[model samples]
Target: MLAQLTNVSLSFPDKKVLQDVSFTVYPGDRISLVGPNGAGKTSLFKILTGRLNPDAGAVSRAGGVRIGHLEQDLSDSASGHELTCMEAALEPFAGLIRLEKRLEEIAVKLGREGHASVLMEELGEAQRRFEDSGGYSFRARTEATLTGLGLPESLWDREVSGLSAGQRMRLALARILLEEHDLVLFDEPTNHLDVPAREWLEGHLKNSKVAYMVASHDRRFLDAVSEKVAHLDRANLSLYTGDYTAFRGQVERAEEEGWRRYEKSRKQERKLRRQAQDYRAWSEAGERAKRGAADKGFVSHRAAKVMKRSLVARRRMEEAAENARAEKPFEGDEIKIGFGPSRGRGLIRAEDLTIGYSPERPLAAGISFDLSAGERLAVTGPNGSGKTALLRTVLGEVQPLSGGAGVSPTARVGYFDQDHRLPARDVTALEILRGTGDETLARTVLGRMGVRRETVSKPASRLSSGERAKVLLTRLVLGDNDLLVLDEPTNHLDIETQDVLLGALEGFPGGVLFVSHDRHFVDALATKTLRLGIT
Candidate 1:
C-alpha cells in the first residue's frame, strides 16, 4: 500500500466536514475524488500529505515513498524562475545531474593518472548509481512530458519567467509529471487546459504507472482517468468500484432504493394510524354504554371490560404507528432558473467578425452567425482562440477589430463572466440580490441554491469559488434576461449543479450563446456551434 487513512474524522467550528472517513491507496491505484463544492476534498488531500492533522484517525504510509502534489494555483511554480524551460523541467533530477558530472570528472582523472584501480572502482560505482536513478533517460522523459502538455520544442530553451499564464500552468504540470514520484495528487489540474491538452492528460494518466488521486469537476475527464471513485458527501466517504459513470449509476440506484424504503414505511404508518382511530371509536362507544346503563352493576361491568380492551388495543396501535414512522429521505436543495419573455425575435448577429485586441494580429476572423429567440450557439476552440473575445464583442464590451456584430436593442442580455467576479467585493450575496427590491425573493433563491443563512450574510469576497459562481448564477436567473451570454459557466460547479444548469438552459425560451470546455454540456445544450481558430 502507498498510504492508508483509518477512521478519520475532521470538523471545523461551524460544521463537520468529515466523519469516520477511511480509505487506502495502493500501488497503481487511479482514484478520482468527487463531491460537491465545500465538501472537504482539499482538506482530505491535506491530511494525506501530512499538511493537516485529522481530528481523529490513524494515517500510515510506506517508508521512503515520494509523493508529488499538483495544486490548483501555479503562481509559486511560475515565479522566480530565470531558468530556461528545459532547465526548469530538469530541476527534479538535480542529484542525478550532479552524479553524472562526477562520473565525467572521474574519467578525466583516470586519463591523467594512468587508469588507477581506485578511480576505476569509483567510476563504476557512480555509473551504476546514475543508471539506477534513471539519470540516463530523465532528459528524454522531461522533453516528452513538456511536449505532451502542449509546450512546443521552440519554447524549450525560452525563459520560464516569460511564459504566458497558460504555458506556465502547463510547465508546472510537466514538472510534477517528471518528478518520478511513487504517487501523485492533482487538484483540478485541467482548469487552464484546452480540450486537446485535457485529452492528452487523460491519455497520459491512463498509461502511467504512478498512482494518482485527482479532484476534478470535469465529468468526461473523470470518466476517462478514474479506475475507482471516492465520493465525499454529507460528512461521509463512500468508495465505489469502476469509473465515474459507474459510480453515478450506483449512487442513483441507492437513492431509488432509499426512496422506496421510505414510501413503504409511510404506508405502514398510515395503516397503523387508521387502526388506532378505529380502536378509539370502539372505546368511545363502550364509555357511552356505561354512562347510559340503567341496570347499574352488570351492564357497567361489561362496558368497563370492553372499554379496557379497546383502550389497550388503541395504545398498542399508536406504539406501532410511532415505530413505523420514517423520516423523509434527503433530496438536496433545488435550483429554479427561468428566463423572462423576450421582446424581439433576433437576439444577436455577427457578420465576418474579427475579434482581438490588436488589429494587426487578430486571434479569430471571418466568423458569422445569427441567433434568434430560443436558439443556443456554442463557441469552441483551443486555448487563446478568442472565444471570450467573441463573447465580449457581441456584448459590446470590446470593439471588434473588423466586420460587424450587434445585439437587438430590445433584448436584455445577461452576461456570466468566466472569472466569476462580483460587482462589489464588500457587498454580501443577500445585499447584492436584495438590491433588486425583493429581499424575500432573494433569500428564497439563495436558500434554494444551498447557500447557508450565515454564508448569505458574509461578504462576497469571503465566499468560495463555487459560492461565487452560485451567486452570479442567481443574479442571471433574477435578471430576467432575454438573451444570455455565458463564458465557462460550469467551471466550478459540481456535477449535480451542472445538470441543473443544463436543464435550465435547455428549457429556457431565450437565446443562449455560451463558450465552455465541457464537451458533454456543449453537446446536450447547443443547437448550433461556432468553431474558432481554424487555420
Candidate 2:
C-alpha cells in the first residue's frame, strides 16, 4: 500500500467532522473522494499528507514514499520569486538540473586532462544517472504539461508573478504533475480550468501510473478519471467500487434497500404489537373468570392455567415487538430554492455588446441575446473569453464598451458571484439574511439549504466554499427576485445538491443567466446558449 488511514476520527469544538474513517491508497489506484460541503474532505487530505493530525486513529505509509498534494490556495506558491513559468514548472527537477550541470563540468575536465581513469568513470556514472532520471526529456514533459493545462507558450516566458490567479493555479498543477510522486492528492483541481483544460487533465490522470485521490465537484471529470469512489457523509466513510456514475447507482440502490428493510421491520413490529394486545386481553378475561368462578376447585384451577398460558404468550409477543422495532432512515438537509412571482416577460437584452475593462481593447464584441421570464440562458467559452464581463455588463455593474445591454426596470435581480464573496468577514450568515426582517423565515431557509444552526451562527469567513454558496443561495431564496444571475453556480456544490438546485431552477418562474463550464449542469438547465470567442 502507498498509504493507509485506519479508524480515523476528527472533531472540532462545535461539530464532529469525521468518525471511524478508514481508507487506503494502493499502487496505481484511481479514487475519487466525494462528499457534501463541510464534510471534512480537506481535513482528510491534510491528514494523509501529514499536515494535520487526526483526533484519533493511525496513518501509515510505505517507507520513502513521496506524496504530492495540490491544494486550492496558490497565493504562496511562487511568492517572492521572479521565476518565469518555465522555470517554476521545472523546479521539481532541481536534482536532475544539477546533475546535468555537473556532467558538463566533467566533460570540460576530461578535455583538459585526457585519459584520466577516475574522471572517465565519474562521467559514465553521471550520464547514466541523468538518463535514468529523465533529465534529457524533462523540459519536453514540462512544456507539454503546461500547455496541456491551457498555459500557452506565450505565457511560459512571462514571470510567474505576472500570471493571473487561474494561470497560477494551472502552473501549480503543472509543477505537481511534473514532480511524478508515488501518489497525488488533488483538491478541486478543476476549479479554474476550462472545458479543454479539464479534459486534458482527465486524460493525463487516466494514463498516469501514479496513484491519485481527487476531491472534485465536477461530475463529468470524476466519471472520466475515477476507478473507485470514497464517500464521506454523516461523519463516516463508505467505499464504492467503479466510477462516479457507478458509485451513484450503488448508493441509490443501497438507499432503496435500506428503506425496504425499514418498512418490513415496521410491519413486523405492528403485527407483534397487535398480537401482544390480544393476548393481554385474553389473559385479563381468564383472570376475571377465575375471580368470579362458582364451581370451586376445577373451574378456578382451569381458569388459572388459562391465565398463565395467555400471560406467557403476551410476554413473548411483547418481546418480539421490541426485537422487531426499526428506526426511520436518516435524510440530510436539502437546498430548497424558489423564486417569487416574476413581473417582467423580457428580463434582459444585449445588442451587439462589446465588453471589456477598456474600450480600446475589448475582450469580446458583437454579442446579442434576449432573456425572458422562465428562460435559462448559459454563457460558455474558454477562459478569458469575456463570459463574466458579459454578465456584469448585463447587470449594469460594468459599462459596455460599445452597443447596449439592458435589464427591464420591472426586473428584480439576484446575483451569485463566482467568488461567493460575502458582505464582510466578521458577518455571520444569519446576520446577512436577517436583513429580510424575518428571522424565523431566514433560519428556516438556511436550514433548508443544509446550513446547520451552528454553521449559520459562525462568521462567513469560517464557512467552507460549499457552505458559503448555500448561504448566498439562501439569501437569494429569501428575496423576491424576477431574474437570477449565477456565475459558475455548480462550482463547489456536491452532485446531490446540484441536482436539488437544478430542480429548483427548473421550477423557478424567473429567468436565469449563468456562466459555467460544467457540461452536465449546462446541458440540464440551459434553454439557450451563447458561445463567446476569444478576441
List all candidate RMSDs to the true structure: 2.9, 2.7
State how far residue 398 of model 1 sits from its true place (Å).
3.2
Which is the leading candidate under TM-score? Answer: 2
Clashing pairs in 2: none
lDDT tens digits, residue span 1-535, model 1: 9999999999999989999988999999999999987789989988888988999999898898888888776755643578988888888888998998999899999889988999999998999999998988888888888877878798998998888877888888998987779989998888878788899999999999999999998989999999999999889999999999999999999888889988999999999999999999989999999999957979988999999999999999999999987778788555454445767889999999999998887999899999999899999998779999999999898999999999999888889997797999999988778655556666666665657788998999999987898788777767778898999998878776787678768878889999999988999999999988733
Best by lDDT: 2
What lDDT tens digits, residue by residue, belong to model 2 across residues 1-535? 9999999999999889989888899999999999987789999999999999999999999999999999888754643349988888889899999999999999999899995999999999999999999988998999999989999999988998898888999999998898869999999999899998999999999899999999998989999999999999879999989999999999989888889989999999999999989989988999998988866878889989999999999999999988887777777555344446789799999999999999778999999899999999999998889999999999899999999999999888899998898989999988888875677777766665566788888998898987899888767756778999999888767776787678778888999999998999999999999999889
Worst ten in a row by lDDT for model 1: 332-341
Candidate 1 local Cα displacement, residue 28, angstroms = 2.4
- Candidate 2 ranges beyond 4 A from true positions: 75-80, 106-125, 333-340, 419-428, 434-444, 459-466
- How far in Å is the alpha carbon of 21 misplaced in model 1? 1.6
